[model samples]
Target: MTQALSQTRTGGPALPQERRLVTDIPGPRSTELLARKKAAVADGVGTTLPVFVEAAGGGVIVDADGNSLIDLGSGIAVVSVGNAAPGVVRAVTEQVAAFTHTCFMVTPYAGYVEVCEALAELTPGDHAKKSALFNSGAEAVENAVKIARVATGRDAVGVFDHAYHGRTNLTMAMTAKNMPYKNGFGPFASEIYRAPMSYPFRDGLSGEEAAARAIDHLDKQVGVANLACIAIEPILGEGGFIEPAPGFLPALAAWAKDNGVLFIADEIQSGFCRTGAWFAVDDEGVIPDLVTTAKGIAGGLPLAGVTGRAEIMDSVHVGGLGGTYGGNPVACAAALGSIAEMKEHRLDARALEIGTLIRGRLEKLAAEHAVIADIRGRGAMQAIELCAPGTKDPDAARAAAVSAYCHKSGVVTLTCGTWGNVFRFLPPLVISDALLEEAFDVVAEAFAATA
Candidate 1:
């Protein structure tokens, strides 16, 4: 282990610098801020906790009331490199001083091309690739669908149940959850079909069985020939951090190629070293025809991209794929800096290290807690699914209570899954071992309180 890691593992030096809580969590100032926020901010923007952050660095969030909370969620995994990482801060600062946006399409810039080159080189597969930048993961996904359809001359797009693409009309149609994302937000984009995902926690299906079931459904219903893209999350994100069975993705990719369908990997949440790999598809060596990325791409800036086989990406006309802010130079510079940081700091290895620690702790917890139905995921994108002891019925109440308890106890976490039973931990890859240990302690306390 490096000296920094060694320092982090010990509570001596790391605690004073990395975590310092001076007030109760969600203290007086935070409560006041929450009241002001409720008056000013839209009600649609709901918060899991009412705490207001005044600053963040390393792996901890400093709230307005001087309470420092361990940030296990990392702003929904958008800050993989850590909050206010030196490289990212420097790049964003310099880029903003130079010029924020000139619209890459109208006034081309070097930063945009540099980011694309980095993505083309880093993403999985050895195939020649082309990339198009976008403003969000949803836009990248939407554009990937357009490119695939244009390339293959097919109208129907196939998605899996429990998949979460985005909030756009089309992506909401692509998403499986209905409450906040898709309930009143229809009528969505059409010709989008959903097949069942292989969720071992619930479906209990093997890779082959799941693939066969999905293929069977497609054959009997949508007919493969009509499909232009088969969009899947290499690791199901909101559907409970389930890694598809070993051969599941490769088999599906082969089927897509054989049937003239484009395999689109929505790697928005699982990419950029968050999964201990450059891309989640690397686990199986599955080369997707198109891949959508965002979240951690710019180390928290709003930037996303779709990189794929050159021919498929080239099918769209020049005017077909870009938006005004699609590759803003500042965002591009941040992306380049974030990629450099990932390489220099070796965040992928850090993710694995963190995952090893979290898995060990969560497994120990699961062994003791009957409500912890399963503990799963890879690298730093791990989760613990709560259930009603031996029953498959989701223990969402327990999950929510656990989250509530964690928040009050000075730890931050997030929940996912169609049933809201999965508690996902997306700590920044740069998090200190001491802080992670503290967060784990908070979670243990929460579990004990809730259980």
Candidate 2:
């Protein structure tokens, strides 16, 4: 690290933005907590890293043992405004003191309405829009499907290969992976169909060709008349940070409009400035009929929303939507604050800067390491797919080894992909360029050591 890269406090956190290790990762306190967690928590609740966090902000998470680890995962892309962001903190504090919850469905609140208005203004399309808030990405997705089905009077919903919607029964059926997300959980919901995705690295097809193939499959397998909506992540997230080839999304959107099918953009993990745009679909000028958002929307609070054309969103019966905790007052406040922070800071531009730095570093690493089969994604949401040295065979073992190396070295990295051969990077947008370079240096070392 250079003197110019010296640590400086950012994100208004109490701790300085620096990586410090006083003990081994998952050190004494975290290990003890792990033991307690094992005894009290369910075995199914898996963790990427064993270290238990005491506090986190900017780009570092402080563990119980005083180890300050660089945060590259951003709690699975949920804290893009940075953990404990000042705006979120202040809004949440005031809201909590005023009132916790009267239930939005019962009495409603200004925060919830304000958040809906923000979503309407921010999401793609100049047409009149409406929004319904939910508690998670899954809830938003499920609701979007419900709205589409009601509006179109169609039963079938289409998803793409390598897609991951959520853990709910309906979303599980829509998800492509079967291991942990689907496994024994089914019997799942009906009328859920799967289609091919535009994965440029693997398929080697042009965007227009790939979209044609997907449309062909849907038309043959599930007729357009029967399909309610074709939901997709503008940039695939859990399935790997796969950005569909250029022109692919626009083609699909055109097809959906030609037919009566609703084009639902699942922006759960890629929205809120994480992808250098308000939403990934904006890159290709694809205006989706329905857009689902979560993860980074509320700093770290649980809030999700489905925003779309006014008529379609209002198609569903008044009481047909909503849950007990869908738009909790506190979460709504956090969403307001989070959106304020994003607009004030222009984190979208910051994401572009961070992406340029990280992608450039990874490109250099890829040039050196044959194990890096592909490097892809936009803004802070980037990833490298690990493969055998001489072939395109997925090398999940190498990915695992590198992740372990990162964990031991006190960098909180994450891995994802259908085959588990992808090392994804989702650093907080608030992360400084110097810190990002430091994290990439650690990543480079891991690749070299593992190789």
Candidate 3:
């Protein structure tokens, strides 16, 4: 019998939890759409899956060709609370009915204030905090830098190797990757310096040692007095889901504090219970002076925020901050709804359960397969790096083959990493054990056939 999943929500569809393939991977309709897309859409905008999505909820995404594929990417960790969630749909519907855009800068609304209040309450610190919302993670990050500079009267910003901040010019400079992100886009903003990051599997350095090395580099290279802030992702997202060794973040935070440099945690991908905590910095009791959030903030809406200590955030003049659509009322409503779903469902605990389940399956696969190099990340945000058998050399081709196999087999998966050799798994917190297990069964098959 086909697995019968629970209904999504009041207005949400009752999607089947099981993966089903009615036709080959992209089918005919998707192929036709692809041709249209190629003719119309820019070549730079790429699609991971050739098929177009018609519906998504619970643990599956139904494609235009009527094939239900198990969702493992969660729209790159944007739909952590699940797609078409009840609260999100209800909130957006009601907000759109009332009014669309008032230009919060000219005329503010309650929803924006509520979201800022919620951000103050949820983000890591207990101290008084304030937030400024924007449209994307890059905006949040860029604004964080602005706030840091204004507060400290410094020029240089510090970032680590293998970090992915965003694509905006300022953040593009902060991001560590070259190709696809920074290549041919030079003449980037100045005064951004890069330091070493702690990669346990490859660097083999303890967290303390790595932090010391990085701190020394910063002091010598940038000079503490000239540095404004040190921004880092608690767990790297696109540059591989690389988790720094234990003690690394706390040490960095301490150094920044003692040196009067701000610590910024770019939690764009790891916040909102995606990492078994409200924010990944919460795991080690390391509170950042500023946090940039976006991806999972508003039930997939286009909303981002930079939350920080009141004094730091208020350093700017009254009219110094805000944009035309910084905090759209509709987006704020969606944020409130998303937060409600996350809190009500206790998705943090759910993420932990997901981490345990997926880790067990990946561990078994790694033991049986030599190409499975390392398993890392926390909560539902886990990944497995692929490498040459018995060696740490990255095998991007093998990773591509395995990902292609999964896509062909009715599973929606995504591969990331600086070398493009890590298979990232960011399933919605609402995913069922049965569906996850089934997805991994296909992954195991991919390894057996392609690896």
Candidate 4:
């Protein structure tokens, strides 16, 4: 018997939690909008799916053509509390009515201070902490580097292989993938160095060994004295939900601490109960000097933050870190509401339930499909890497085919990886178990059809 799951709890704009295809995948309305987008929008701004969304809530996104699709990607992990979550909607509505932006620099507000307090309480650290808000993950990352540089008085920044930081010049240098994020963007910021990551599936190395490899590279390429920080995603997001080997992070963090280098955890995609924890680094108890967050931070509002030790955060000059829209009053309210929702509903625990169900289904699919090279991740941030049947040779073609199949069937799935052979699932934490199981069935069918 199929086990029944509870309904999604998004209180506002309740959408029927079912996948419905009224027209073709890209329906006539979507096709028409695509033509307009091509004419009005820049060719550089690419979209994963061309289907224009009219409304979304709970576990689904409703397109302009009246098709309801299961949301597996969560808008790249932005709307984890669900689109139009009641708390977020109410908070945003009230905040907008009261005031929009006061340029926190010119005039401060309680919302910004309240958010910082929340961050200090939620992030993995018991010590004194402070935060500075920004508008995007890229800006937060850039600012974190600035804080690290000033605090440590070092110039070189170290990152790892298969990392995706951001699109800005410095973060592009920090990022590892080259084709889309860094093709023509040349002469990136200097003093940015890359090291090998702890990819057990590919490297076949133990966590300690992987840490040694990265440390050796950093020691040889960028000396500890010159290194300001070692920034990394606890679970690589666009690099394919790759979780570093068990001991890799701890070893690296220890080395960084010993050498006076700051450890920066870029939890932009993996934070906020998406990984069954407030922050992914909590799994290993690796406390970082600085943590950069966005995506799920403000329940879809444009807000990001850098939370770190008070001394390190305060080292920068008073005027050094303030943006016109940084810590916008409305975004801060949404963040507060989002945090309240996470705690009130215990979405962290929900993430674990979601992960167990997803991992179980994907494991069953892997048993039947030889192309599934690996299944790995924590909580709702899971992925299946596609590869040649018997060996680990990445098969980007198969990944693309499976993704195309899911899209055609009205399931919004996403593909990622440095090799482009990973099919990732980032379902909203509020998604129903039944919906997840149904989506997994579609994924299984996609794999079988491709096979």
Candidate 5:
């Protein structure tokens, strides 16, 4: 919370990949900008850390105050290939120079088609798949529901507890969180039901048992005939990186098949090598009927898509789907560049390496911290749920304190989950071991000081 006069961007230091705090947290320049933002920006739009980012690369962000903070939150799981990645930069610059937009719905271009092709090729399953591009994860999820309803002629959608689909009206109805997401903004869309998730730490039910309970609940409550789709995040993202028990996803996918309901895997937060694989469901060999993707899909550009069985995706009327700026050419090109970076660097394996390293470090932290109730998630997308010592009561305050401590120490961290007690880490895949270890060192210091 310390501050001094704002520093000017005299194009300082070479933007190194290390954590360098040249000023206090939210230094003078950032404070001034924060003042401007408060004056001009809507109160509804809140910032996690108010330090204005001047530049970011690799695993660090350079703030206006010339502070380099180790980025443990990769812009909320985007920029997996790193900020200003060579390929993404090249593609974006080239596309910008060539043309900006023609509206894909009007004079469709190759970039959109190419991105769709990539989705089909990379998404789970060898079955004939087709894709439709969108502007965000919410759009992809919403469109997946539309495709499923049109294909099945059903009105009901089954979502899970601790789910975070999006903030759109229809998605708000589908989402389980209430406070910030749906609190007063309800009278939401109808026929969206919630099923219990297979949370081993909290429920302690076997994967099969939890899946059975969820299936039975949906069957008895919603009736299979009326269910258009069952949407879920394979590795629950905003719900604290909660990875469903091993058999949960497969069982749900199977039930969806038996019930003629489309199984939609919302990979918005866990896809694109974030979970040590192309998709989190891949760990259990669960091939969803429809998979929605965004976040890391287009480097940092806004791009998302729903890739599913050809028939289901094509069942909708040609004109029924699409938006004015759904698949911007610049975004599509960025996706291409991002995909190239992923392939060339084999980031899938890199994610696994990061998972192992982070999981190990977190395990050590948990061993010393009684507040760590659960250590979960996969790959670079990991989290530690905080609770009162020796009890299951979520310690949101402790989580917030630890996060704040990290923030002030020049380490960017994030907290998530329905209870706001899950401290999650999503470092860029390209981060170096030195930086990662140093970030964890800072986290360890935060824990000791907070304790």
Candidate 6:
């Protein structure tokens, strides 16, 4: 490695390359563990692959079966600060040594309050805001809806198609994709409705057209007046990294205001500088009444938060929103350190840097491959969609093959999209340029070989 990258502190190509496997992916040891997992783990816990990991550090994940894999997926965008980041490790270690859980709602702790204060200061908007922490992103989303409904005294909550809010009963109802997430899980929460999202790749509709279509639907079908809140992922995550068109999000925000509806931006996957901004909604300079965050918020730790207007947040009665382990000391400590690392390292700029590199490389690949239909995303949260050339139908098989190829080659990637044709890249913002370029090289080779 070059001296510059070798000595660097954060993500770029300065990191080490991952080692490929000489044996089957689930080589001996992993096979043994998989068998044990089958007996001990619940069936509901699903994994994309059978690779069993021993340890993960920096931008690489080492499997128990003796394979070191590049982590382009970053635990599905949860570890943007990197795996085993020094800051996170130090904070978590110190916090765990002192105390693990105190039940913030019961006894409270400095760490929890400190994290909330940090969120109040860090999340988008200059207005006075308050925060309520949760154990997962879905809980934060669910609470945001509840708070909005109670504040507005309206029962109807509007969500967009292709959105993946969470798997909880209410979130399942709010989510747009039905197959895997909502399939066989029914009797979902009520008062939830789906609106058309602005997906430029397959939809072929302009921002104005998409927003107009959705607005017309609301006006004619549901009537926005009955809506309490309109929740959306500023950059749709599982629905594909589909960024709202130029006029789409802004128009929706304006309409929400006009119709007395609260706007909630679910920044679970795209927030905390992953999109080259604190939150994706800030790109449009639109202020959401409520902002839901998780994933990268606490590095790899499980911590979710909902930050919004102080008045609206206070509207909820005491004990109405909170959890026992929502902001555990360990999670809060990790969050504090993660935020500090983000600012000190300028991860926002790093995200833009990574975005440019990946986009350029993927654009070249798209030009050469007929199946590569579109390249879209913002900052480090980028994705490529596959299609049967000349047709809008999804090519999920090709996407899956590409993912498997990447896995075998020692680079870990993920697939998303309602149609399952999009390959998403969620590398940690702290990854080195060298490691990133190397991973991209593997991805390109995978596509070339498959082609």
lDDT of 4 at 254: 99
Q: Which 10 successive residues of model 5 have the least lDDT summed?
A: 1-10
Model 6 weakest 10-residue run by lDDT: 1-10
Q: Each candidate's lDDT (Cα)?
A: 0.87, 0.91, 0.92, 0.93, 0.90, 0.86
Give TM-scores for every candidate, taking all chains together and pairing residue i with residue i. Answer: 0.96, 0.98, 0.98, 0.98, 0.97, 0.96
Worst 10 residues of 2 by lDDT: 1-10
For residues 74-97, write the lDDT of model 5, one tens digit per residue: 999998988878789889999999
Higher-ranked by lDDT: 3 or 5:
3
- Model 6 RMSD vs true structure: 2.2
How far is 374's C-alpha from truth in model 3 (Å)?
A: 0.7
Candidate 5 TM-score versus the reference = 0.97
Better of 1 and 4 by lDDT: 4
Runs of candidate 3 with Cα error greater than 4 angstroms are 1-6, 9-13
Q: Candidate 2: which stretches are off by over 4 Å?
A: 1-13
Candidate 5, pairs of clashing residues: 6-28, 6-29
- Preferred candidate (lDDT higher): 4 or 5: 4
**Model 6, stretches more than 4 Å misplaced?**
1-17, 20-22
Off by over 4 Å in 5: 1-13
Model 3: weakest 10-residue lDDT segment is 1-10
lDDT (tens digit, per residue) of candidate 3 on 1-451: 1133324531355576779999899988888899999999999888898998888888888888999999999899999877888899899999999999999888889999999999999999899999999999999999999999999999899999999999999999999999889999889999999999999999999999999999999999999999999999999999999999999999999999999999999999999999999999999999999999998999889999999999999998888888898989999999999999999888899899899999999999999999999999999999999999889999999999999999999999999999999999999888888889999999999999985
**Model 2 C-alpha lDDT per residue in residues 139-249, reported as the tens digit of each score:** 999999999999999999999999999999999999999888999888999999999999999999999999999999999999999999999999899898888999999
Query: Compared with the true structure, what per-residue lDDT tens digits does model 6 show for residues 230-295?
Result: 999999999988987788998988888888899999999999999898888878898899999999
> Which digits, one per residue and each the tens of the lDDT, describe model 4 over residues 93-133?
99999999889999999999999999999998799999999
Stronger candidate by lDDT (2 vs 5): 2
- Residue pairs with colliding backbones in model 4 are none
Q: Alpha carbon lDDT of residue 350, candidate 4?
A: 93
The CA-based lDDT of model 2 is what? Answer: 0.91
Q: What TM-score does candidate 1 reach?
A: 0.96
Q: Cα-based RMSD of the predictions, in order? A: 2.4, 1.9, 1.6, 1.6, 4.4, 2.2
